[model samples]
Target chain A: MIGLYIVTGVALVISFAFDRKKTWAGLKKGWMKFYKTLPSYLFLLMLISFILLLSEDFIIENLGQENIFLGLLFSLGIGSVTMMPGFIAYPLSRILLARGVPYMIIAAFVTSLMLVGVVTYPLEKSYMGKKATILRNIMSFLVAAGISLIAGLFYGELV
Target chain B: MKKSTRNYLLFSAFLIFSFISWLVQYDFGLAIWDNFLVFARDMVLILPPAFILIGLFDVWAKNETIEKHFGKTNNPMRFIYSILLASTTVGGTFVAFPVANALYHKGAKYSSIFTYVTAASLFMIPMTIMEASILGLKFTSIRLLASIPFIVIGAIVLEKYFEKTAYTLPRVDQK
Candidate 1:
């Protein structure tokens, strides 16, 4: 994060040096874009928190080892809809692993969690349009499933 | 209703729901609030610089340059460039979206933009390091390797589909 700030600072300084008016215009444009999207972002945050709170226990209970296919399905389903930081997600996956959820299931969960964004659907649609957003998510879901299957076969846990 | 008004209404409804949940179950409401605070703080810290960078890119970067490298060329190197650029992204897709939008308006091909967006989520350096530490290098490596081809293919296929349909991106007013 600090790296981001440093880069932006240097860029801003250089931009201002080169052309003060254009730099100011750039800043104003950035602010306008941010302001326009602020509402959607707020809604996304609220939805994320609510989903996380409601699904925590349910996720744990459903991702057990009794049924592999069911577990993978649950992982993909939950992971696609929810968004959390990597720190929280990795630790949660570790906990799930300790509880005997197979590597394949965990891989499916993590992959889908990172790649697919059902929760970000509206926000993405606002930028990329509905067709692109839907296509991207669907493609991501397929990729997640494929990667997990490969991980499963590699770990010999799918059988 | 206007889109912004609808969003505000939905946001308020969620807030009210949280309040009701708090009344019924204090812990659940507290968790939601805490999560929201953490996420909001992260967003506030991260988003401004991202937007600023996008703004600068929009104002300064030449359209001809974007077109030369990432535009409607048949060059496979564009995908590589897209992924390489994406790996440098600090925040998640939130940042990537605006950057992708800037690139698009600057004449980048749809396939390249899609590659950038998808790869942005997967190839962040910090996230990869963390995943490797927790999940083992083997697991991380396999997933990364698998992702490259899938992302490229998916982007290409999606681009083809869009082209066949003569689809154009919907323009939201910047002002």
Candidate 2:
């Protein structure tokens, strides 16, 4: 996070040095972009918090007992809806692994958790349009599913 | 409904839900509020600088430069460049989407833009290191390797589909 600040500060300094008017323009543009998206972003975050609070325990409880197909499906479903930082997600996955959740299911959960974003749909659509957002997310879901299966086979969990 | 109105409605609905949860279970409501605040703080720390850098890029980056590397060219190298760039990105998808928007406006091909967004989520260096340390290097390596081909292929297919449908990005309003 500090790295991000330093880099942005350095870039802003250089940009100001090169051209004052353009630097101001850039700052204004950035502010506008940020402001415009602020509402939806807040809404998305609130929704995620609600979902995570309600479902986290339920998901953990249900995830452990399912067969491979059902496990993968459940993981993908939960992963798509909830977003978390790597620190939270990775440790959680580690705990699940210790709990004897299959490697492939964990793989599915981790991949889809990062790649698929149902909660991010509004933000994505604003940038990429509806069709592209839908297509990209659907494709990501499929890719994540494939990755989990491959991981399963590689670990010799699946014959 | 108007966008602003819709957003306001959604926001109100969320607040109401929180209120109801509070009424039902005080702790559950408090937990939800804390979680929201935590995420909001993180976003507040990360997003401003990221957006400022993106704005600078928008103001300074030459379209010719983006086009030469990632434009409509048939070069497979663009995908590699996209992945490389994605790996270095800091602020996750929230930041990635704005950067991708700037790139698109500057003439990057759809395939390259898609690759950047998808790879951005998967390949952040810090995230990968954490995953490796927790999950084992083999698991991390396998997931990364497995992801690359799929990301590339999915990007290409989505690009082709968009092209076939004549899909265009929603117009970003400029004030």
Candidate 3:
């Protein structure tokens, strides 16, 4: 947490320093502008609600019973879509694990859920350009896989 | 960002996602090579409506009012509020994008919006706690710690690229 804060601070300073005028004003004028956009935030909440409702069934079935690979694939698949709130995903995941899901697959699912979502493609395209969005998502997805693989190995060693 | 009024587009996407999710469940329910296709289908269907709503927000929101409050690129508070709002949030990543994008258009700095995305991605308090218990402190800590740099860097890059476009009203003097 602290490292992230420090990094964020440093990055903010460096980014602001590049275009001093825009950077300086962004601290104030920019934020107030964001405040006006609060209603947009609701979209996220709505998405979460939908996922929680829909995935309840999925979670009930697979809890405490997943392997690392399956978890990974589940995460990747879900992450690509962009739905499934952490609230729903985590509990469902825990249940799946308790039921018999492999650790690797659960780890994979968590990574994918957080790292990538296919549904966001259009929005990403508009905001960051299509190529940038695609490349970034791809890299993030790959990282998710790597993380799951390492996690599975570590768990195996510990047990 | 005018409303596309293409209601059918969103409906179609929703139906498609639903079908895909169903297909994934059926194909991999027992075999379990990877059930990603199911989740992907589910998430994709939800985005079209999210996009349409975002388009409306973008078109209707007053840029001036936004600039007056949250348009600061330098203020630390900008960062504070962004993380607060985003980290506290829970939702699908796909749906979150356009809403954030709309805010960006209304003058929210890219850095702030990026923070929102990153925070939202990992903001589940209970989940973190559970992860620590199940996965151990070392694993959870390592993952959380590593994510910070990624989030900060991602936010920084986004801010740089998303230069604010001055919002001017129709037939009004450019301020």
Candidate 4:
């Protein structure tokens, strides 16, 4: 996060130096964009919080080491709704792996955790419109499921 | 409906839901509240820089530059470059949207935009390292390798489908 700040700061400085008017216009655009999306994003976060409050325990308990079907469904639900950061998600999945959770389930959770965003669907809709956003998300879900199946089958006994 | 009105309706729904959850259980309400605040903090921390970068790119990157780099009619290098650029980003897919939109505005091709979003969402250097360390190198490698062809094919398919679809997708205007 600090790195992001530093880079943006430097870029801002360079932009200002290059063209003051353009730099100001850019900053204004950035602010407007942020403001315009703030409400939808807040709503999304609230929705996610509600889902997390309901499902946090359910996920840890029900995502067993067997039953690919149930695990996939559970993981998909968990991953699609929650937008946990990579740092927390990877470690959490690692702990699940250590606890003998099915690799397939964990893989699906992790893959969809990054790729598919049910929570952020509205945000995506604004950019890509309704159809493309839905299509991309469906494709992403399939990709995540495909990766999980492959990982689970190949490393069935190994892990 | 106006976007603002829709947003407010969603926010009201959230508030009502939280109130109902609170009535059911105090702790559940508290947990939801805390999580909401945490996410709000995350947004404050992450989004400004992302938007700033997007704005800078919008202001600075010429249409010709975007086109020259990502506008190839049928070149493998365009896909590779797009994927490479996307994979280097160290943030979530939400952050990528503005940049991708900016690129689209600047005349980038749909296939390139598709590849960029796919790579950004699925793979990144830091994410890859984290995955390798947690999931082991073999699992990471397999998933990574498996994703490449799927992403490419999916992008191509979407491009073709978009051409025929009733809802016109966004396109770069010729300058």
Question: Cα lDDT for residue A62, model 2?
Answer: 76
CAPRI band for model 3: incorrect
Mind giving the per-residue lDDT tens digits that candidate 4 earns over B23-101?
8877767788877877778788888888888778877888887888887445668789888888866566777776777
Superposition-based RMSD of candidate 4 using all C-alpha atoms, in angstroms:
3.7
Q: Compose the digit string of candidate 1's lDDT tens values, residues B1-175.
A: 9888899999898788778877888786878888988888989999999999988888899988899889976677999999999999988898888788778888899899999999999999999999999978988898889889889999999999988998777554367
Looking at candidate 2, what is the lDDT of residue B129? 94
Instruction: Give the alpha carbon lDDT tens digit for every residue of B18-115 in model 2.
Output: 78877788787879887887788889999989989988998999998899899876678999999999998987888899888889999998999999
Across A24-62, the per-residue lDDT of candidate 1 in tens digits comes to 888888888788888989989988887887777777887
Chain A TM-scores, candidates in order: 0.95, 0.95, 0.61, 0.87
- Candidate 3, A82-145: lDDT as tens digits: 4554545666667766666665666667777777756555445544556546655775676666
Ranking by TM-score: 1, 2, 4, 3
**Clash pairs for candidate 2:** none
DockQ, all models: 0.69, 0.72, 0.07, 0.48
Better of 2 and 4 by lDDT: 2
lDDT of 4 at B44: 82
lDDT of 3 by residue, B20-87 (tens): 75677754322221233344444444443333334334444588755554576366566667666665
By DockQ thresholds, what CAPRI class is model 1? medium
| TM-score per candidate, chains pooled | 0.94, 0.94, 0.47, 0.86
Model 2 C-alpha lDDT per residue in residues A1-159, reported as the tens digit of each score: 899999999999999999999999988888888888887787788887887777667767877855789888989988888887787788888889999998998899999999999999999988888888998999999999999999999998888
